[model samples]
Every structure is written in structure tokens, then in C-alpha cells.
Target: MEPEYWDKNPFKATAKAFPPGFHYRPTTLNKTRKFYEFILVDTNSVSIKHFKDPKDPNLNTHSTIQILKVMQPRHYGSNLNQPKKFSAPFDPTRYTYWDYIDAWTNVFWHQNNKYKHSWLIYFKNNTTYNFPNWFLQWWNYFGPIPQIYPEEVQQGFNQFSRMFNNQESRIPADLMYFSSFALSWIFSWQYRYGKIENKFDNSKAALDQVKNWFQVHPEFLKPADPETSLFLNKKSQLAIFLAGSKSKEILAKNLKEVLHLLQQQEEEEKPSKKKVESSDENDDQDDDPFYQNEDDCFGISLEED
Candidate 1:
């Protein structure tokens, strides 16, 4: 039996019949003939290849693993411009965010280059960005971040934001904290409705840290009185509570309700039902005017955008 068409030329065999969520752009580097760059449009992942053999023009026969690079969308002519941050160059190996974190832990803590530590070192050398002191402290204290569940990352980010008043340089400790809490909530829910996985060392340590913080600052755990509680909808509540001269205690007081709500939902949800989490991080690219009038099909460009 013949293989599927998508398997034959997954990228642009025909002008209009390529796979969804993927894009192809023709390129030229040196005298390389008929070179093309395949891109995962959604993830901004890119892979470049040169087709030397006419029999294997389509990438279906090519090696899947190559130099993979992350592409940052460039705004050619718009006010939506910001200083460039360090972006990893084309790497021969494909790495996930987890791998990056692991390598970072090994390199930063042990001063060991045993792992694939190039990414972090490259980032540090190329960028002029200043990370927060607290963020650096968190990484130093926890070495490798603990394994986090897919479901709890958002909640962890939110809780962490509340704790730090939505600072741009906030640590992912809260996010990791929620991953640690995953077991408790899963068991708690399973006992009532239905159930959940691994306990990483760093995750456990993070849980302990959060617990110690709460123990020292018990007032944050206290519920705010409804009568005098601030009336806040989504728009202004975060701004008022998480970004200002307000104290951490006051921020925690306001965020207390959200924590309760998350816990309560686990009990409320029926067995086999999955909770859909809306992403809090928004990409400013969509709102940028640069892409508003430009063609989506990006051709080859040797120079930087």
C-alpha cells in the first residue's frame, strides 16, 4: 500500500495542500541549490534543509533531526518594537523546556558542563537583560526545578504572581509549588469523585519553602471579611492587588479567595472531567500593527528583520 500524501511531502508539495500548523519558506545560504526552511508556525520552531537529490525533493525522506532554531517574529515597520533578548541559535539537538531547566540546574549549581549547558551560557553572554535577584535566588536554592504537571503550571504562576505582586522578574516557585500540590488535590478530589503521579525532589523542597513562608506569614492565609473586602472584577483586581505600594500581606488577603476557589473546584468537578485552563500570558504579536498588512507566507531573507 502507498504511504499517505501528508507523509510524502508534509510541507509544501502543493501550494495549497500542505499540513496545517506548518509553513515552508525557500532560502539560499551560499551556493546551496533548492534549500527550504520548514517551520512550525504556532511554536516558531524552524528546520532548514538542502535538497541535493531530485528524487527526494520533498522533506519526507530527509532526516527529522537537524539544526533546530527558535524564530522571533520581526516587526519590519511598526512601533511594536522592543529590545532584543538572547535567543538560542540553531542547535543540532531538539530540547524541551524541561531539558533546558535541567541543564541550567546542573551548570549553575555544580559548575558542571556535563549536561547540554550551551543554551544557558549562550543566553547569559548574548543578552544584556537583568534577571531579578529573587529569581536568581530561587534557582540557586532549588538547583533543578521539580517536575511540574501540565494542569497546574498556570495556577502556580498565578499564585506566585500574587505572592510577588505580579513582578516581571517573578520566580516560577509558585508554579512548581502547584505541581507539588497536584498530588494533594488529585487525591482529595479522587476520594470524593475519582484521581493522579511523580514527586520530584525539587518539587518537595519547593512545597516546603512555600509552607515555611506561609507559616512565618500566617496573616496571608487569613480570609478577608466580605463586608470590607474590595469589590474587584478581573480587569482592575489584579492591578490593584498585585501591582502597587500595597504590602504582600494585603495581596495575599485579596488572593485568598482565588486559592479557595481552585481547591473547591477539584471537589466540584465530576470524575473523568478535565479542567480547561485559559492561558494568562498573552502574545503581543497578534496585536502588533506590523503583521496587520503583511503577507503571511514568509519567503527567504538572509538579513535580520
Candidate 2:
């Protein structure tokens, strides 16, 4: 039988078209308006049709190949609802299929909607399965999957940081610095309030990472430049404030010392107004001796006499 006929009439006409004694009955459990499922009588053979309207005999079958070419045999007992037990206890050393499920689901949830399609393509091209593991894992978690573990997030952050650091030629240094700064602040806030138990500790750890980044690249926090220093100071103050009540005092103290150092550096780099005025006066005196020794009542230099 031609697949196009099957696509046009689905199981409706296919069951009747089959030779006499061939048993086929539609299964209701998996049947939907757009999809039809049928099983052979006295046999385990089953077929699913992605048909919108079986009554329309002229329905286009152009996309039918796309659906049929990828269809795999559905093993009845291997459904996701059926739990499997392994002989040995769960092993952390070797990952089962489930680990990839959790990892990919967490990635999908964290990505922006626009970027999600790229993730879909990446998984489709890279993995053996057409769908991501997380889609199945979602049912096991009983709700939306938990945010990725902190260690995984930290690893991602570090990897991005390294990538940004290496792209100096492609991206401007200042833009990279600002991007990292914004990312650090965002991550710090998320760590504090993203339903983590150790909110304060995680937030502080995130801020500490930002602090270390600034320490390594001091030019990004140039005290003499108001443009750079203003943002640096604001970020530091915000980070300290977000450190929670417990660590507020310690963070405040450390931040105060940093600001004090910046102030001192600013002062040392700037020329004093009084020194400039004094130098100008000395130049005037050297140009005209009379200006320095205001000769008695005549404003004439004694040396000229």
C-alpha cells in the first residue's frame, strides 16, 4: 500500500483496505483529533498517524515523509511511567541516561526564548535522540526542574569569563568589563534570592568573585577617572548592601577601605590648585624683579639702580 494513501485517509481507510482477516483497531488512549493510533489485532504491531483530517482525500502529503521517516517502533512496556530498577545501587561515577536529562533541562530553562531554538538545533545535531532528555525528566521531577546546581552555574560563569577575556581583539576591553560587571551583579542577586538556602553566603561568594575580578584588572576601577570610578563605587556599595544583614558590617568595612584607597590615589594623581598659583607667582617674580621687591615707593628694582 502506498504511504500517500495512508497519509490521506490514515487508519480510517487503511484498516478496510487491508486484506481480509487482517485485524486493525484504533486505540483510544493515544488518539487525538490531529493524531491517530491503531494496533493490529492479535499482534503487537502499532502505527501512529499525524493526520489533521482523514476525510479530506486530497490532503497534502509533502510533510508526511518528514514524520514517517523518523518514526521508531514503540516498545509497549518501556514507557517513561514505568520505573526501572538496577541491580547495583546508584553510582555517581558513571552517569545513567538521566544525568543528561537534568543538565539539558536546566540549560533550556536558563536560556532566553530567542536563543532556545539554537539549543534545540544543537541538541538535535549532537544527541542520539530527537528530543532532549529533560522533557522526560520534567515528569519525574513532578514540577519545573530545579535551577541548575550552584557548582554548575559557577563553572558556566568561569567559562564565559575566560571566553570574554580571550576575545579582546573581537570585543572592546571596556565593553567586556561592563558586561562582566553586569553579569556578576545579576548572578549575585539571583544567588541571594533564587530560593537557595544559604542565600547570604552564596551572594557574598558571587560578590567576592566580582571583587577578585576587579582586583586583577584595576584599570577598570580607575579612581582618577570619574566615569570609571563612579560605576565601580556604585557596584561595590550595592554588593555590600546585598551581602545581607549578617555580613553587612564586614563588607561595609572592606568597601570603606577600598574607597579610601581610591580617594588617596585620586588626590596623589591630581595637581593642587594652591601649588599651581604659587608657581605662577614665582614665574611673575622672575620675569620682573620689581614685582618681587616692590622698590620703596617707586616700584623699581634695586639691582637696576
Candidate 3:
């Protein structure tokens, strides 16, 4: 079936295809969409709280991203496989998202590309308003499946984010994923965001002004603001607190831990990527060098613009 424009974007998450985040007709995308996809979910589906500091009076000091947390039943994946140490391992093959659905969902869902493919169809049956646990089960309890290549996921996601920025609505997670899928198509096949070909030998457009395009475009809002979410009530703000200050120290400590884990995932994914390039005969291999490199076409130094 021909996909609708409002559905998937070339750069959307899981653009090319993800081998069903939730498998089985019962659990996979056939049933749930939200938990695998969106942020600021139905409040009841997942519990959310702003980090509080009883030690200090300022309960309101956190990065715009700090307030997110997803809740789940305690016993979901503890019986057989343990949850991977990292909450959101970029290498999904090594990690299971289900150990704690909300935690994992927030990591993937918070970004725009959650469930990038599902939006392509009119999914009236299986759905999720928030993140899904069944998707996480494989990573958490059964041990990792063949992980999706991070380079590919990254490319799909960046394009997904760009496409989500292009949308005018609250950006449900699935839609965020789809828009980038659409954009990824543009990045690879179309050159222009549709079917038209690129006239230049290499169609590299500078990314320095890409965010500027977001600034101008209503559909794509800065990840920083309330404008981007139906959920994040507290608007995004820039703050430079004293480095030695107690509150700043705590936030820094927690965020640093999260970033460190993400760093390790980055490293592991990095090594596999080199092998992917050098090898010539793998059957499951992908076509583009990787989605991330495309950013060079769009990416100017963040310092510049």
C-alpha cells in the first residue's frame, strides 16, 4: 500500500524496517504502540515525577530532560535474564527493553523516533498511548536479539528528529519515528524530500542552518520547549548553576552516570560498525554506509550556527 505523507518520513525511526520490536501477534507492534514510542505518555500508563531535593529548597532545578521516568511491575523480567546494566543501550541486540518498561521506553520514546514504522498504516487495533513493556521483554529477560546497528539506528533517528521537527502536532512517538523514516528516504534515494533526484554530483546540504529551518518551521519545535510536547508542562530553560553547589553537583552526578553508560554503548556500537564496513558478504547487511554520516551533509559545527 502507498504510505501517506502524514505518516512516515524518510528519516523516521525504524524507517527501513525493524524486525518487530514486539514479536508475536500478541505482544509486538500488532498490539502495543505507545510504550514503544512516545514520551509524556498517558500519566497513568507511566508514573512521572520531577526530581526533588529535600536537602535544598530548590526542588525545581533539573535539565528539561531530567524529570522523565517510566514505571513498571517489579517482577517482569527478574526470573530468567537480568536487565542489561544500561537502561537504554544503543545496541538493542545486547539489551532488553522489557526489564523495566517505563525506564527503557522513556529512553527510546523521549526521542522523536519511537516506533517510526507503525505510523505508515492506519493502526486502529494494536496500539500504545505510552511506552510498551512487551517490546522490552526480549532485551531484559531473554537476552539480546541481533541488535540493530547503532549507526543505522542513529541515521534513522537523526532524520526522524528532523522530520518530527517538520510536523505541526504534539508529535506522538510513532509519528516522530515515521517522519524521520520519510526524511531518511530523502537522504538516501530522493535527495529532495520526495522522489525528485539531486542535481549535484553529491547532494550535501550544510546542517549549520538546519536547526534554523526548525526555528522557522512550525512543525519542528526545539526539543527544549513545552511547545514540543503535550506532556512536559515545565518549559525548557537554560541554567548555569555554580559547579560546586550541592544541587548542581547532584544533578551533574546523576546525569553524568546516564551519559557514561550511553558512552559505553557508543563504544561497543562503534567497533561493530568498522567490521560492518570491512566485510563484503553478509546477507543481513544494509545499503547506506550508515545513517549518521549523512549528518555531515547537513551538519555544520554546532558552534557555528
Each prediction's whole-model lDDT (CA): 0.33, 0.36, 0.35
Per-residue accuracy of model 3 over 187-267 as CA lDDT, tens digit each: 111211222224311112224333343445544564545545633432222123223347866877856765676578779
- Model 3 accuracy (lDDT, Cα): 0.35
Worst 10 residues of 2 by lDDT: 117-126
Q: Candidate 1, 220: how far from true, in Å? A: 16
lDDT of 2 by residue, 27-86 (tens): 232222122111120121122222232555444221110111112224323453443343
Q: Clashing pairs in model 2?
A: none
lDDT of 2: 0.36
lDDT of 1 by residue, 1-305 (tens): 12343445322333244222222221212111111121121133323222233554432221121212222223112322432222343322233332222222222211011211111111111122223333355334432233323334334434443554223324344433332332222211011211113432224324345556455544344334543443333435656645653787877876786677656866786442432222222335556667554675467586887
Count backbone clashes in candidate 2.
0
lDDT order of candidates, best first? 2, 3, 1
lDDT of 1 at 40: 27
- Going through the candidates in order, what is the number of backbone clashes in each? 1, 0, 42
Report lDDT (Cα) of residue 288, candidate 1.
68
